[model samples]
Target chain A: MAALNIEQIALDIASPLAEEPGALLPILHALQEHFAYIPTEVVPGVAQLLNLSRAEVHGVISFYDWFQAEPSGASTLYICRAESCQAMGSAAVEAAAKQHLGIDYHQTSDDGRITLQPIYCLGNCACSPAVMLDEKLYSRVSAESLVAMLDNLPERES
Target chain B: MSVRVYVPSDSTALSLGADDIARGLGEIDLDIEIIRNGSRGLCWLEPLLEIDSPEGRLGFANVTAKELSTLFSDGVPGSAHPRCLGLTEELPYLKQQRRLTSARIGLMKPCSLDDYRAQGGFTGLTKALEMSCEEIVACVTDSGLRGRGGAAFPTGIKWQTVLSAEGDKKYIVCNADEGDSGTYVDRLIMECDPYTLIEGIIIASLAVNADEGYIYCRAEYPLALERLQQAIELATDAGYLKHFKLQVRKAAGAYICGEETSLLESLEGKRGQVRFRPPLPAIEGLFGKPTVVNNVISLASIPGILAGGAASYQAYGSGRSRGTLTVQLAGNIKRGGLVEVPFGLSLRQLLEDFGGGTASGRPIKAVQAGGPLGAYIPPALFDTPLDYEAFKAIGAMVGHGGLVVFDDSADLGQMARFAMEFCAVESCGKCTPCRIGSVRGVEVIDRIHQGEQVEENRILLRDLCQTMIDGSLCALGGMAPFPVLSVMEHFPDEL
Candidate 1:
């Protein structure tokens, strides 16, 4: 959350990775890791670095659910919407979270605390109704547990 | 010697708060060696604390932070606590299994070369190194090990094609983009026993004469990715990797990329789209080189085949569907976890014996065999034995051995809608039937569900499904209709 040198960061991440075969994904992933979002400005630079058209870069970012064009909320809440989770009553889990957060899937909360997304599966099917708070996964999650998990979040410093 | 304790580091255990258990144990003033091992695939009892004793690894199920105080009350060796499952290997769930590919999972430090070697890991590589490429291929051929990721294609034949394919630069690609709702075997291998997969890949490279290899893993699997990175470095440093250079490529989150051709496209750093076959990935794939694109299980099975001899592996299962199938039981089931059984195990027995019936304590209505694209089989056909041909006979395919159970409360009508919706959301948009037809299928299912010209919509939906099944370029478009059609067929009253 400091003032970032976007160009410098992009070049530092993209330069070495772009040398590898099929380098575009790793570069994009690294850039996303450095800064939570892929900046619109960096796409052209990445395209130039990878020797791909801007359209191609944009297309890949748009296609995969992982890459984002703008900054996401501090915490991303991914609820599994696939069949196994559905069987375990994830519909109720999704409804409760959406209601509690006052936001829908693909929407960031107004306070910029949480952004919600629907993931197909987290590969924790046996413990169904899985939810991921960013990189950490939580399984056997109920609506009550999710709301509690979401409520305990400390607000981000501006 | 200090008492050894195992706390699983696999994604499932972590999700269920295995980290907390590890932390709790850290605070305890006991002379214990806390080892972060992988899960026993006994997920229902996850956060399962195992302690080494004169008997064996004694399991403590669903251990809370508060439970740790009492855990060591009787001393270093585990006690007969109320929750203690004595002799973990002798537990009915485990004793019943015929573990092969996943034999080492949940047993040792995943990235530790020493632990892996101690457990007879590198013998496969040593054996593979001794055999010629043709001999290895022949051994696999005789084993009759089909692709575990569903297609049931003979693994030996696929390798033979790539082996003979005219290309100096052949590539070995491991498809670890496991997005299926009910499957976790791939994730387990990548996160828990990563070196096994690495060994499998190295053996594959030797068999096909490929210098470079890539594991096309999903970015969703953060732990698996991290573990794999560590495992690769450890294997490389130990010189087990030899000249075969390996790298992990994070998949751009697309369900279609789980398909081999689309995966190759994604690895090329492009939008994942279905490519037409005939030039098959075996001949011209991944930068137009002869590539052997295999599922994690398909590759992981190779080491065992080489080390144990093909006939030993082939002896387990019936017919052409030889060797053990890593059946992942999930959804509304009691005892849901990984069961590595031979091919001909009865589906009903798998559910009732291994699964111990529905967790909801309700009548089981249907089970979705395979991933999202598989058919929803009714309980009437639960007696069906698990085989490629047997499942196919019932208008189903044992795609990836993922059996997601559902109780009586589940609405087949709504699930039929979701199958199309999932397709619409994840479709690569290459073919019209998949891209356009999925959207239409969702609409038609909605219309039918709403009772808006239900009969007309039903007919229309069937026609649409037929078109998608017949005309689509890839399995994503072609097979999305399978679930819907199966639902309509089995639960006739629902839709």
Candidate 2:
């Protein structure tokens, strides 16, 4: 992947919206929404704009699991692995996804289309075997349905 | 006519395909306004739906897009489906809750300022801004409010400490790093009623005379982080958070940072490790200045206390443990969700009445209240009222109002092992008793589980637990052994 122009992007987004007392979170959210991940190069710029140190900006970004500094794949998949999901055959679904994708947890697909991640719980114990694909959530997912769902995704060419 | 529909923003509701229902409804292109709200805690028939009419909010249960049109055609105020629990307010579980901090939850659109204001949002802050810092502290003291973060320290005294401390650069730190398993109340409050917490934090900052505040939330809650970020923006724009310089910081899944001192270190961009206290956080914290580190619920309760006045707040609960308790009912339970009740409710009532017993359709053997560090109580002790003193008498601490139930299938010995293992993984390695003791405790418990020198192993494990409890620096190491020891004492048959 080519290097991102983080400084330019930060400048475009920076304003009074980025400097409020609760500004750090919204600024971080906007940054992630626009860039998918908080760019390391823009850390200083964000810090300067918010009157926070680069360390503070980096610390806040790194502390929350939602903020990612690295580039992400096209889509993110969060498979539930909590006790409730575990009881309802999520383990089987997880195994199948791993086999089908041929990738480990937190790793992106070779074609950079999908990234698989593990989530503790989705609060859908009754449905069991839940998975979140991008912003959309799926429930009562069987191993068979998981594969079919993946295969149905729009194909991407390198 | 503006037709109103409600879909839950609760994680459990989303897990049960509420998102699909919402999306499906959105796709219909109808002349209706669909609002996503929080859970009403009726977990059995989740993805509960509500329709707003000129009269009142109509309720539905386990609703799907396929049934929406038929339900609309019926013209019923509430669902007649077998799953429907009738009027939501009339539900036994919801009716019993005190709901001080959670008053607005599941009732309003999460991001709508108008919805929040309608539910009496910012009223406490508006009232608080009229009082001096001393008056605020006195009000909290009069309310008899204590820390809900397990320690049960008096909230008023904590604020007074910070207020009395000699420092211009004091800080208020909100500990939103809810790492304890089976607890999600903080996440729920942060997501559904984000402005309440923000308002509470701002009030706290003002009382402590702090120019800046920070909310350190864990990384696991992506939805919560998004909502909190949005709330912060809205609050700041409205000049609420601007009244004091308050910020929200996110923790990168480090369980150890739930301990106040370690949380401070993580905020300073270091590894989330615990620090020794002679200088408790109230004296020197967050960049070597006095800081008030409190849990989310503790901070969130401040607005209600300020608005209601200390005496009115104090009038609800039993001796010492005053105000409402926001209990996160989770684990092997039929109706697991957040429920806030006054301090005097019994454990049995919370588990059986609100939680609806075991979720697995098995008999409940034990319950662990107050997070991982809390003691495991047998079913026989269920009648005990959930107050700090009552729990203390029974050798339990209400760490955070997390009640994790377990069915008969649960092995106490294995659970003990998990407690030790959790400590071993989360220990900041700052103290020997926690770092080294937890690993040894796990090994000893494993030996007992393997049936090797059972009595000897039991005695050794007990000794190890005592040592860790006494010698550890912070609650991380200090209270790690509580659950393990409690399980061993109460459920020897499982061993």
Candidate 3:
């Protein structure tokens, strides 16, 4: 990751959306997309631009599971833990992944290779126990397949 | 002429490696035109590749990368193949369906406005352009379209309220925050037939006198979000959306956000907390103004209702549950996918005829209708017809019309525990019963499972459920007990 001037980046992102209704989400989304996480330093800049309290911005950011405070691992794996997936033994799949990765949900590997998160549904109930690595969705994902997929991913450091 | 090979780009199909199939076919030098369409909802047979034959779209199931070369070599759709499933409509699972709202889903290019118009797409909006707001609301009221997002409140009535409400800047917000498990129909439509939803939103905007709109799609559905953004851009550029300004907002993960008030709060860039309902959304919503918040399906169905006319749409369904229900078959079911049909169908027909029973080849022990909040109906009540009133009569809701099948291998006790856990995890903490009672419900179920004062815990569980039902502000707490109590009532042995 490049060394970013937080003030400049936040201004560039938040300036355009300043006039829009409920501009906080868009500003946050832009920051998250560009940096992969919302840095604490950008909070004051966003709050100043949007004229919202830093606490309000923080509240919004913290409420959403999508918004992260720290930079995530190179790859994020979202495993559906909802009812349909649960029915098709996703619990077992999740258990196996946690065991293999040696990390629980919402936690990253020590090497910062992967971040595991629990999703409610992937809207792929027919193909139960669905998994998503970033944008790509994989269904019928058993623990073995997920582990293999993780192993093959290009190694990266946080 | 090149053969038109339709491959589903729907999430379920994509999850099953449909992208690989599409890419592999594109790389080949074959004279085949690949059309990425939505899933026909026959999930077991996906990635269901269809060839536009003279007879109709001939179907092939589970087409993998290895089979692609063989499929092309054997004259493709022209020759007989082992994997071929004959005509797409002839498949008993699809043939029995009455796909009105989903008519153009699997047949057209999802993002192309031209393709959408070619398939009777914006006819409703055109008709709506001519009609008065009251007339439009009346047409929908006559059509009897209800909220497909769990609550079966009449959409037309809601629209009428929003239309009549005195607000200078009313809003039409489409709830695409499809957090329900075993439900993919909304996502499918938004991805496969986005124009329908866009057109429906336009019609809704026109009907409610709301010029500005926002589609609150969840962040989990990247593909759906992408497709919708594309569709909106094209529609905007083409001047098809001149009447209304539309924008898609990504909903940060919150199950309570699916609730209208919570969704409005989230839209305002606040924590998705449930709001008190004396000032209903129709009167004062979305920035403290009158808002018409409709589900994706409820809005998507508007175009169909308008194009076909209210009487024609009203003619299809049974009783007050007018219009077809897009029932999602999921979980352990064999043919799990979207099944759009009139509301008169029985659970037996949905489970046995459409679902092909349990995927495990074991007898189905239980089925959870609606969603996680729905009751776990025992196999004995398979004959129960799929109607809002009928389902309500049996202490169940046809919530979002998602049915998850469970064979004998499933433990109802675990499912009951999960229902409580889901509520606890997703609750907005607005009310005590939902926030605290869900935790207590899980503890009681766990205690019962551990054989520690089982009868006493069961009684305590029932009492807690009643309190939650009575005390909770929203359906999250109120309906959490349905699954628990149903599991206890029907499958006490499993519990």
RMSD of 1: 1.5
Instruction: Tell me model 1's lDDT, rounded to 2 decimals.
Output: 0.91
Per-candidate count of clashing residue pairs (backbone under 3 Å) = 0, 5, 0
Q: Please list all clashing residue pairs in model 2, or write none if there are none.
A: A63-B251, A63-B252, A65-B219, A123-B12, B150-B399
Off-target runs (Cα >4 Å) in candidate 3 are A1-4, A156-158
DockQ in order: 0.87, 0.18, 0.77
Model 2 bad stretches (over 4 Å):
A1-158, B27-31, B73-84
lDDT of 1 by residue, B1-495 (tens): 778999998999988778888898888888889999988899999988899988789988887777777766677545556667788999999999999999999999888888998989988989988899999889989999898877888988989999999997999999999988899999999988898898889988888899999999998899999999988988888877778899999886788899999999899999999899979999999899999988999999988889999989999986668999999999999989999999899999999999998889998999999999999999999989999999989888899989999999999989989999999999999999999999999999988888899899899999999999999998888999999999999998999
Docking class of 3: medium
- TM-score: which candidate is best? 1
Question: In candidate 3 chain B, where is summed lDDT lowest over 10 consecutive residues?
Answer: B74-83
Please give the distance, in angstroms, between residue B79's alpha carbon in candidate 1 and its true position after superposition. 5.0
Sort by DockQ, best first. 1, 3, 2
CAPRI rating of model 2: incorrect
- Clash pairs for candidate 1: none
TM-score of candidate 3 against the unseen true structure: 0.97
